[model samples]
Target: MSVEHIQNSVKDVIAYLNENPQDALSNDPPITAVMEDGLRCRATDEDGNTIVTDMPQAIGGGGSAPSPGWLSRAALATCDATRIALHAAQSGVTLDTLEVTTDSVSDDRGLLGLDKSVRAGPLSLRTRVTIGAAGVDQKILREIVDFAVAHSPVADGCRRETPSKVEVRIA
Candidate 1:
């Protein structure tokens, strides 16, 4: 079947389903980690710490040193890279490999208790895309990368910082 044909059919089917909903959609659970009146915000899990911030790099923290906000940005970058690759594949781009890196800088003094000149984070995510395909050229390759960036959900979510509200419900 043609790509356009499949796309059109998929949308139509989705529209019909929405008109006759079968099940309700819900968000996945979100757990917040907190440190009690501490300078560094910390949370522990069964295995240990927040799994990124600072647990103990040797045992899975930060190796005795962890950069602030690195874990959250790492998660975003990883998700972005995978989503980009998936979109590229769907768009007929045979991606040989993908490497994404994110560097975030904030007011360290203020946010991390350095001096009060630090802020949260304005993460700069840089992705180096390399593609190897028999028939794809430079122009097409550029388009592929653009498409990947455009379609990545994680990239969009991070770039937009889509506002969301968390409601705690107690029953």
Candidate 2:
């Protein structure tokens, strides 16, 4: 889609929200993941798009699809890149290229039940964004980057901690 179209769509949404604040609330349908084989599973979204997940051979699963942890980091990086593009387009800054890299540290001991103190998930994540645009000043580019980071939902989510709970049911 054209940048102008995207900007107009965003404006429309903003106007709608201003007119009907209570209608801003929305929910996504639950996603489902099913085991396909040894250490392999398939996750389906509400639209029926499916992604396969698997562990490395060292972890006792076939070296097939990417691990969930890798996917999580990838999601964050992609989201950041997309938001940067959107914000740049809104600002009339045509981006020739945009990239985001994410780094995370984790302790496997927690996942393997080898250590009680170690956390099972990534302890921290860092993101780096690079953008290339013709005729754009360095200051403007920095502003675009700052705006993207400040308004990015994924970036906000990474900074805050959310509670998650799991329940098991016998079938």
Off by over 4 Å in 1: 1-26, 34-52, 55-68, 110-118, 123-125, 165-171
- Which regions of candidate 2 deviate over 4 angstroms? none
Which residue window of length 10 is worst by lDDT in model 1? 51-60
Q: TM-score for all predictions? A: 0.58, 0.92
Q: How accurate is candidate 2 locally (lDDT)?
A: 0.88
Give each model's whole-structure lDDT: 0.59, 0.88
lDDT of 2 at 139: 93
Number of colliding residue pairs in model 1: 11
Candidate 1, residue 145: lDDT: 66
lDDT of 2 by residue, 1-171 (tens): 787888888788889999999998887688899999999989999899998999999988887999988898988999888888888878987888788999899888988989998889888899998898999999999999998988888878778886779999999
Query: What is the C-alpha lDDT profile of model 1 across 1-171, one tens digit per residue?
Result: 444554466567668778877643546454456643322445556555463244445433444435445666676668767666555555656656567776655453554466544444552555555555567687876776687677676668767757778779786
RMSD of each: 6.8, 1.5
Candidate 2 backbone collisions, by pair: none
